[model samples]
Target: MSIPFLAGAVSKLFLQFGCSEVRVEGLPAFVERLKGDRGVLTIANHISVVDEPTMWGVLPISTFYDQRTVRWTLGASDMMFNNTFDSWFFTKGQIIETFRGKGIYQKAIDTARAKLDEGRWIHIFPEGKIKQDTLTELRRFKWGVSRMLMESKGGRGEEAPLIIPIWIKGFEEVMNEEREFPRFLPRTGKKVTVIIGEPINDAIEPLLAEYQRKFPHPWVPITYGRDVQEDLKEEPPQLAEMRSKIAEAMRQELMKLGQRVPEVEAREPTKIEWNW
Candidate 1:
């Protein structure tokens, strides 16, 4: 499916769900700052499954930017790219699948790096899972994004990638994990807000330190291989440590964005009345 077409469809779906008011902050200026072939990595809080498509629909339309720049998102293979239809849709939607158990997870990182090298945009949910509990609280972020950023910088030489932190509120009220689809008619006074923070160009060490201070327990390291022994062999002690630090740092950055914004109200959906 064409991106422009998908964007249109998602926009309509968002409207049908009573996404009446959408407010974007700090994204237009960031778009204007884009020069020739500069790569962008967007890190956002995952509130619902609709978060990805909502972002796709909202960003271009809200910013009045060109839709031709390919937007790549890293998604779980089992969840987002399970079947042929989903695979096809997500592929066209620019989702790069990350098969968790499969040894080829690195391939996804490499693919993202390649896209970034070509001056495209990549979106990652560093939190790794949807926060169905609350919009204010964020889950511990996984380390894939940090590793990806490091790899991208190494491949692109002097062209450093920009990391944009985004905070989206009201998606949980629109559609949570309990419902597969967004409500046909939204609750009264429901609004979706997407707040894009300024670009982060600093080193990852400080952010990583902050994350470690908050969550003292170390991140469970990821091992890649067909079997346990092979997995152990593939991941050395030092490399695993580095990856964990980077992942936490990325998570911290996203959590910081969430902190800056006001907490989204946790509302229980009321029973819908269908006029027969």
Candidate 2:
């Protein structure tokens, strides 16, 4: 096995082994979205540092063998690409090197868009950072997500990539940021629940329609999301509105998904779960 694939397989097993219990709901949506022909944009709330490697364990083991079925994610350069080995590791894991204050139009975002165009799956933490607050209380989403929304394309014209909102609970407990000792090692016996939401087209289509109506040209150029376009001189007022609306809509969807999932508080593998 390739280094990346082997690492992924081990992480998947490690997640299943570490947690006291891990549960997943709405897995069919996850299965269907990835299997679809169009690019997929998965937005999830950030809970812990291990979110990427651990949360992905929800996927079937067979999916790991197919790198395309795995996700290409935007990771903080400082966190994931600081040193030589780490950079190599994260890159092999399909993570794009993203800077924190560099705004959204940098090479990382563009790389992400290109990956999406290839019918790949891109997962993002819309909150843009780890916020281990209440499951229902989510941070305001960054406009980068809006940029991805406006920029990502499916096979057909004007067809946005499938938007799947995911809410992962209990990952934070595996390696709480608050823990001081043995900080790098993942703790065992934690409960985790993964809640996959349905496609959010219905909630976002109206916003997209309004964006098209007002712009009439296209919602392509995002000040915070896309590379610098030639025609873009000054950003219009509506662009900010559109980006904020899209970001907010994503937040709302995730919060609602969290509410629907009672496992967060109960910490039970309530529904049908894929576990060892």
Candidate 3:
């Protein structure tokens, strides 16, 4: 499975499905910053299932070529090979599956390391799940990304992969969840935008750690229209603080990059959502 072939296939599929006019920013500068280095990690905000494909479609081909030797480690749950076509596409993309509590952490790290050594890139969504709510903003980020960066650098030293933070917008309503696909009337298709922010090098950790020290005291835990209380109970104090800070930092950064949609204020969890 050739990477270029799969990238084209995925890019074509998104283009066919009304993903027109992808607006990409800062790629040229970022590419220049990378300076022929490809072994890197991209951290993104998860808004929809199409995010990965959209990213692939928009990334500069030359940048990918520079990092031609890399593989993207995708979430294990993302491997939904419902048919032969899907399986083929996934393989071609060089996507690797990663999971928790399955002794797969080292595998993901190793895979990323190998790709970096080969002068390629790896991509991951710092936000683990898709946020379907129109009003709800990005959820808090897990510690996995931080942990990965820290550990990778610890072992490799100067060979650590660079961390790039990418903020994307307007991908939530690609397909209407209520009426399913092709059921709703369309006046104008939504516009999708991807904004690539500056990369985070080893220097950013202390700032990140500083922010992590301030999260979660007595403020409201984010409610997602459900009894997510169980999920909230076990959060360690430091971890909870870290997540909150990440969410805040992400929100601020996205807004600065014009990726934040404030017109839609997120709603509290509805009764129906809780029952469900």
Best by the lDDT measure: 2
Off by over 4 Å in 1: 12-17, 33-35, 62-68, 103-105, 154-157, 179-189, 205-234, 263-276
lDDT of 1 by residue, 119-148 (tens): 878888877778878777777666567656
Give TM per candidate.
0.74, 0.86, 0.63
Best by TM-score: 2
List lDDT for all candidates, in order. 0.63, 0.76, 0.52
Candidate 2: where is the Cα deviation over 4 Å? 154-157, 216-233, 263-276
Steric overlap count per candidate: 1, 1, 2
Q: Lowest lDDT 10-mer window, candidate 3? A: 267-276
TM-score of 1: 0.74
The C-alpha local distance difference test score for the whole of candidate 1 amounts to 0.63
How do the residues 1-276 of candidate 2 rate in per-residue lDDT, one tens digit apiece? 665557666666776676667777777668767877788888998988888777777676667777678888888888778899999888888888998776666778778877787788889998988887665699999877787666555312377778888888787888787988889988889878888888898888777777766766544444454333332455676777787898898889888888866745465564323433
What digit string (tens of lDDT, one per residue) describes model 3 on residues 189-224? 666666677765544455444533443132233432
